[model samples]
Target: MLSPRAGAPPPSCPRAHSTYALAQLHAALAKSGLSTGSATPATAAAAARACARLGHLRAGRAVHGASAKLALLPASALLPNALLHMYASCPGDHYHLQLARLLFDTMPARDAASYNILLTALAVGGHVDEALELFEDMEDAGMAPNEVTVVAVLAACADVGDMDLGRKVHSYAKRQGYCGNVLVCNAAIDMYVKCGCVDAARAVFDGMGDRTTVVTRSSMICGHAMHGEGDKALELFAAMRRQGVRPNGVTFVGLLHACSHMGLVDEGRAFFESMEKDHGIAPAIEHYGCMVDLLSRAGRLHEALEFINGMPMEPNSIVWGALLGGARLHRNVEVGEEAIQRLAVLDPGNDGYYVVLSNIYADAGRWEDVARVRRGMKLRGVKKTRGWSTVSVDGTVHEFTAGDCAHPQATAICDTLDGLLDEARRRGYVPDTSVVLLDMDDAEKERVLARHSEKLAVAFGLMTTPPGTTLRVMKNLRVCRDCHAVMKLISEIAGREIVVRDRNRFHCFKNGVCSCRDYW
Candidate 1:
């Protein structure tokens, strides 16, 4: 227990009790070297607190070590908890979790506060499952979970997409009377959203007793956009505005993403402009990417190029990639080549730009230009990014490459894909072989495009998952245009939902329509 007078200061040292106490303690610690080890725990604790306030991880560790050596620490529970918090707030280091766990385990009798510190350490480190396991251990040890514990556990559940675990945690929070806490409620909303339980997320958002923060609103908007509910997302944005909660950068990102998904180009443009005028939030690179995607999807390639040119900051690889991609979509080979030139200047060693430029020339039937780009790539020593996809099934991530057939079940997987392709073709699916950049004959091009990693992943997903179950896949590269079209048809033929998160963003394919609305 902290003495009631601990936070107070002697009248003679009134300045020491002010908010600047941590700063003052830091200055005092500088005068007293660690080797001297002359400072008491109370003095060291003050210094650690100051370092934590300044976000100085190195200084805080030194003070913590000094305090342990001096034996000046009060054997009180609050002091240790405060010290543990100082360690937990440092940047992502495994040592922080190790130190926090040690402190929690060594405490004479663990309390809710001690568990809170350990739980937070696990959650921030992305050890979400471990955090939830500790939460159960905390309860089994007879410590009641507090608001902080609920928040941390919910965050963990969100990270792992464990909706069942999240709901159980939610029920526990309600039983413990911690559900009323605003922070816990906000985290619950976030967890629900991340778990793809959009309706549940909305319920949490609507049930909040207090005014929702910008982060909560942003999460809800993101959830709606991800689930392809653009109208609902816009409604929430409007409601947030009506409640006088000003949107921030994150909020605008969600709003813009919703507009992009629905192909609401006019609305997207207005929101992009309003980011600065209405919210005074400057557009970041991601925001610029969204604008370009919106313009390009709307068939305004020249306008998209103009937008890129007018940006106050230089565009990065993502911006250039989007420009090259848009020009290819519109068959504007000249514009695509210009974007590739800029991309080459910006990222001299990136092979993706070279590949994209070659594909553009191939689409335009300019074999000589394709050959020249290939030669330039060879001279510059840039290697193309290989297509790869990974699918998490039964908690195991399985990787596959283009045309890879090395898995134990390779025969079954390929046969299943062939069957799915036949079914898709019977339903009017045609393999778009134009996306293949090879300068070979039509038969070779068709064969190369059919073996793309995404298609293989989809084929594996179809064979493994139960019929009608949604299959989620992740890819390191953007989904090729042909792969995108094939997936749309595959979803209908297989009667399953497929969610793919590529290098750019999420694409949900269901009933032959992508979340990106053919714009991406």
Candidate 2:
């Protein structure tokens, strides 16, 4: 396999003889200056691969410049593919992301691996739309996709909430005879679940044949928890036990989350205990966070506090935030104050904690305390992140923020909201003005609540989509009490399923009943 034409060393250079051995090649590059400007494309490819393996981003970028300047980039697809991978694998932040795409777009030629590498980089960097476009380009070029390509594309589909595109990718995978491939199946399961098709996800899981692994099982568990099917998730866990498939930390994370979402207080405690006793897996911070949320949501705020105080390790903001959220829900000012004190020490600049504490005081009619909290907020110069929502329909994603009245279809959406308001009154939709926290009039509070991002997105979904089409909305924040109530009534009136994925979990509304069961 050693050919000097392809950068394989002659009898003299032993370390650089094997292109597959990146460690030895890295040593060869440093010891022999193999990345000379006059080096062939093949030599540079090997050097770039070595740099990638050694995490030498500076050297790799220099190799990239030489490859372009020496006109070695167009010598063969192999070198460019290697260069593409080098840029993608380099250690950097957003700069690496930008460089990866720039290299991808400028490649003289590309194969399936070229697309796969860039797609993976984009997917990991949260560029779902660009990854999907690259996937389409690969298809348009008539390049056959392999298992890795399909997996990355499926992950991108999941992140973008493109159920329609996911189905097509699943079909293509099957056609390519990748139905039995574990990697493809796992990605398919994850994609389907994230796209709000849990049934389809389960079907792929069941049909993966003998290729199942802990990853696949964990994905199934996560899907069930995400869609509010906690019972099914628990049942799947039981099945995993019977099958003797050892559950790992991720499996337990999904289990605890399912229990929390379902309000299964006793079950959550039991699982948390068993993780150490039966499974021998010590609880991680995430697990502790889940337990805190479970206990708090179960109305055991004092127990949650005790649990945090008794933790073997220091409690993080997630744990305190869970307790604070529970206190907010139950209007427990004492616990809220304790949480605020701890949060001020742990995360002093988080405006959210102050807002939650202020709202708690407002709920109790302690306007002066609320005023104090606001003053502290201003003095500390902490600002809350604006809430935003997105609804994807017909391959286009529409975004709405709090007080957003500038969308293209604002008139129709507002009209729909007005109609919902009329129906909301008849259906007993009272604005929970306590959430306002500010000393404002009832009308202003009502307007603010109505213009909330989730409501606007849902209204836009109803206005733009066909009747009976399920509306899928996503929020950057948790659904408030008033909006959650209005969504249920809107589902009943519209006679359409409304699936809202919030910061915490999913809420599916049909016939005035939500999948969260009014807990989350």
Candidate 2 lDDT trough over 10 residues, lowest sum: 8-17
The 10 consecutive residues of candidate 1 with the worst lDDT sum are 1-10
**Superposed Cα deviation of residue 29, candidate 1 (Å):** 6.8
Model 2 lDDT tens row, 1-520? 1112334332211223245555464554554233455577677787788766655556566677766777888877788888778767732356766877887788878887888888877776777788898888889998877887788889888877788788899999999898877889999999988877788899998887667999999989988998899999999999999999999999988999999988998999999999989999999999999999999988899999999989999999888999999999889999999999989989999887888898899999999999999889888988877889999878788999988978988878888898997898898888887678779899999988888888889998888789999998878777888888999999999998998887777888999999889888
Q: Which pairs clash (backbone N, Cα, C closer than 3 Å) in model 2?
A: none
Best lDDT among the predictions, by candidate number: 2
Candidate 1, residue 262: the lDDT equals 80
TM-score of 2: 0.90
Instruction: Name the top TM-score candidate.
Output: 2
* lDDT against true structure, model 1: 0.76
